[model samples]
Target: MIVLGVNLKKIFNNHFQKYIFLYFLVIVFLMIGISTGAITIRTVDDTAREQIINYLGSFSSIISKDADLNTIKVFRYSITNNIQTIIAIWLLGITVIGVPIVLIIIALRGFIIGFTVAFFIKEFKIKGLTLSLLYLLPQNVFLIFGFIVTSVISILFSISILKNRINVIRRPSFLNRFVNYTITMFIISIIIIIGSLVESFTTPIFLKVINNYLTVFMK
Candidate 1:
């Protein structure tokens, strides 16, 4: 972990003075996306709210009833979804045009998390907050940290390419930098995987226990 952090720091060591503020900007966008997502839940119609409630009930039942099955299914989904997101960010980070898209992706991730958390609170009130803190926040906190690092790296690489357009690809020095970027992304992917593992195994058990105790949770 220390080595990975050191490597990531080195990748931006030279450019830090120039591009350090970009991380703050990316975080602002992410926060905007999250706040927007939470607000969106309030705008949901009564019909949509009913649907969400129904879904929650079904989800609670599934996790509570079929422990092994839920674990397998959730693990598969978490792995597939998390890996695809990672790959998309990694690939998109390769080109300058992808910079805006990377920010959008981060925003979308924040939106999803915000919406989920808001929905839980809207439905279950205090109990939902407990669930969110315990089940929703832990894995997502690490994943968000990984994503923030990845986002900053994406912006930096794109800006780096733009600043050094004179035969950037042919320059072996650029290649070394690219290697560092790739390695950093690979490490972030591992962190993402670990987050997914927590979600897959821990989430199911957490939700099952919550559901059992909070019998009046949804319906």
Candidate 2:
């Protein structure tokens, strides 16, 4: 029993080390995406900047006036978008050619996040910072977590496929992996839904509370 316990500890540590490396790789890609996104803000042409400024002004006005947002529609849209993304990742994992795409998806998500925060801060200064925080933080906590997890697992499954291509696992082990991969992706989908709920319901309220204070920055 003691020997078995020690072997289990060793296996756990081995897995931790392996996954930590993968996690680090994913994080690096995410950061690169973010940096690229932030820098892209500075590269925007004057025409585009003006258009963005106009859009932000309009959005700010809506928030400040407490205009009705179609939360249900927003919820459905968010769910649909995330579901598409999740399904893409799941499919990619199966194809084993999706490793690069999976990483790119993570990077893309990071890019969007960075661009959003940078755009706000660039335009509104401190006020923009507040708006960005209120707008993104609540929902992103879950969304980003889901993104990272899904990306890593998808990549891992893809890698497993490659490694086992030459030396296939036993039937039960293969079935276990397939089930695990599918089930885990579904769980991540559920998590993304929670993030969507936050985005639709809670984020609006958060924005509403600060909309009055944000009007000054609109002009």
Best by TM-score: 1
lDDT per residue, candidate 1, 1-219, as tens digits? 999999978876765566669878888889988999999999999999878667656766676566566667777889899788877888877889999999999899989988988987887788778888988888887788778878888778887787778666555577798899999788877878788878887777676665664566443
Model 2: per-residue Cα lDDT over 39-79, one tens digit each: 89999998998787676556666765656666786788888
Give the top-scoring candidate (lDDT): 2
- Location of the lowest summed lDDT over 10 successive residues in candidate 1: 210-219
Q: After superposition, which runs of candidate 2 have C-alpha atoms over 4 Å from their true positions?
A: 1-17, 57-70, 169-175, 205-219
Pairs in clash, predicted candidate 1: none
Local distance difference test values of all predictions, in order: 0.80, 0.81
